[model samples]
Target chain A: MKRIILSGYIFLFISFVISAQGFKVKAGGNQTFYFEDKGGRNQATFFSTTPLEDINGTANGIGGSVTFDVANFAKSLKGTITIQVASMNSGIELRNRHLQSPNWLDAAKYPEISFQIKSVTELKQIADNRLGFKILGDFTLHGVTKEVTADADVTYLDESEQTQKRAPGDLLGVRAKFSINLSEYGVDNAVIGNKVSEKIEVGVNLVGSNKK
Target chain B: MNRNQKKILTAVVIIIAISFIVWIIFGGEIFTKTQVLVEKKDELFPDMITKEWRNKFIWGLDLTGMVSFLSVIIGGFFYFRLRDKKHK
Candidate 1:
């Protein structure tokens, strides 16, 4: 028992040396992983000449991103988001396949869709521990990239209760909404008119943690 | 009317009647089901394409097929009707 206790003290000592590096991940380390809840949908039909039959398709796939220090959202920020194009289902298998086809999205040519944030252009305090920000970045899709900005709301969390058991962390939960015109990014397929809305709407919710 | 005109008129009436029947039986379901061209909004196509656009393309194909099919059915009905009358 004495020997085991001695090794535990040594492990704790090792953890302290790495604490300054980033968010605590494991015990004594400043890193944590979050699985997020996101996406909402409204049902609509297509094929009618009337625009009402069109589906909004607002929420499609789920993805994740990494960031450090939840406090940074109160200022400037940077992050990268990744979403698998192949994994998304629009409720039909063949439709999903065709959607990923070369004539369409070409998921094989570009397997992952992503966004890299260059900076946060605006940050405003909405309420206690809540904030709203506009993040500017290059949004890439189907091998095309364009400057896009997303409006996001973040709620910061206190992690002091778990510090004794885990890493000292600043955790933040966020939901962002954005819109883009597909043609602006050169995704203009003349054949698929009216069925797909040219203006695409997207929303993202994720939780990120960093070293306190 | 000449026999040729009569035959053509019969074919037209037959086509319209059959089309109405099919519509009554299957129109609600076939037309109502949202058969959209599923395109990924997340991934941009090189050109402008949309689910509704694809839906219309498919819808057009289906419509063309139905029209052609009705023509053949009604034309055969008329030809057989005339052939049986000639033999009599």
Candidate 2:
């Protein structure tokens, strides 16, 4: 029995080592949505605290995939994010219904919006313990795909030895900011018949541990 | 099954009816007015209101309205079922 217990401990340790190499993206990350007019003033800001709501509006069972290279932490990030367009919620039931209608997202036809990262610049320390990078990727929305570049900032959260054991790797907080033009993606503003400008601002913050 | 059972069923039916009446009288008006107010607010002072605030109001209405509407429909259905059983 003692020998069996020892082997079990060893097996658990190995599994932990393997898993520790890559950090898992937190679902509760903050994603702020904004829409601006031609004048460049900020118009509307919508927060998607829920990943399910962020992906499409409703909470779908499936989650997005994100992988960061520990060996090349500064160089790149590659992953696939699949969102159910049908789940897009603008708060109002009627507005949600209208958004899903053929005029907007057309959930019945498109159903999903996905993003796949193509490349990223290495992390550079801008301030004390603050790191920043530029991530370039293709964002697919409303059945249209376009290239997008986002600026990301990372901050280290801990320097204590006790905290190190409780949570492995340096505790990292990430914030990414980017913009998209709805017109570029061919999304027509159905709610207001007038053509709403394409520029939409997106900001996301993720907190997790980075290995290596 | 018996007089007691029939009485209980009748009470449930009455409760459901009262709920519907209350919803129509108070909830319905509030729901309608809020909807109109939201539209007007968006149009007249688009700059004054942030998208976050607007979304919050809309989300609250949608969630509350859906719950009330669903409750009424489901409660009515159950109440009618009990009445039918009592008659049989």
Candidate 3:
């Protein structure tokens, strides 16, 4: 009876060690990291600079999931990042209304702006768990879909006592930046050049966890 | 170009100027904004979250455009009324 109890304890210890191995970029196969941050830490920002006004808009409603394969980080990466159109705030009530109106993004008609990651390129190992790469994705905005390449830096954080304070599982910190032309996206507003820039610079900063 | 008309026009200018000066003194915003985004940093994350706070409206006194328009309309009414009185 004592021998059986000792064997059971050994099995439990091995199970804990196997489960706590954490994420290794070169060791694991595929892990789906979810970007739905309940802490409201995920944010996307847009900046339009013109001679008349410099508009800075921010959106906090960002949610998505990305499946990252360690064996093939380039081809096996797939995910969609979405931003709610109505969640965009430009600090001005009138401008915010105009931005969501039919003349601009038409938040009522197309309520979401999303990016579907198609491929990854220029992958460079910044650290043992950090990578710098360019994510080529289909960017859908204002009911128009276009291919855009975003420069991205991603870091993998293993689940530890310190990291568990922020999330329950392994975390992925992704910072990406990209630019878009309003004309190409069918946004032909007359205020594009005078008040708002034709090309808008966009940025996204978020942390995702591989809990599920 | 009479004395009363000149006085009324001067008053209009003063009203517009005072409105503009007060607006500048308070917020100086070219366009009125309802809310302002204040950034807050996280303990471990490098990115920041923005908190929305209510911005003071100054009871429409902060709007230079609206105040200027109303002043011009009221000032014009008084100026034309005085002009017609002189003609009568």
lDDT per prediction?
0.54, 0.50, 0.79
lDDT of 1 by residue, A181-212 (tens): 76776666555665676776766645445542
The ten-residue window of minimal lDDT in model 2 chain A covers A32-41
Candidate 1 residue-wise lDDT, B1-88, digit = tens:
4476577767776766666565556532233333444543412111212232233212233453577577777776765566534435
Indicate which candidate wins on lDDT.
3
Q: Per-chain TM-score of chain B, candidate 2?
A: 0.35
Candidate 1 displacement at residue B63 in angstroms: 11
Between 2 and 3, whose TM-score is larger? Answer: 3
What lDDT does candidate 2 reach at residue A64? 47
Give the winner by DockQ. 3
Question: How large is the C-alpha RMSD of every model relative to the true structure?
Answer: 14.9, 20.1, 10.7
* CAPRI tier of model 3: acceptable
Provide backbone clash counts, one per model.
23, 8, 0
- In candidate 3, list every pair of residues with a backbone clash: none
* Better candidate number, 1 or 2, judged by DockQ: 1
The digit string of per-residue lDDT tens for model 3 on B6-61 reads 98889888888888888767666556666666666655555534444457554235
Q: Model 1 chain B — which ten-residue stretch has the worst lDDT?
A: B42-51
Weakest 10 consecutive residues of candidate 3 chain B by summed lDDT: B45-54
* Alpha-carbon shift of residue B78 in model 3 (angstroms): 4.6
Q: Comparing 1 and 3 by lDDT, which wins?
A: 3
Off by over 4 Å in 3: A1-27, A70-72, A190-195, B1-14, B26-28, B47-62, B76-88
Model 2 spans with C-alpha error above 4 angstroms: A1-62, A126-130, A155-173, A207-212, B1-88
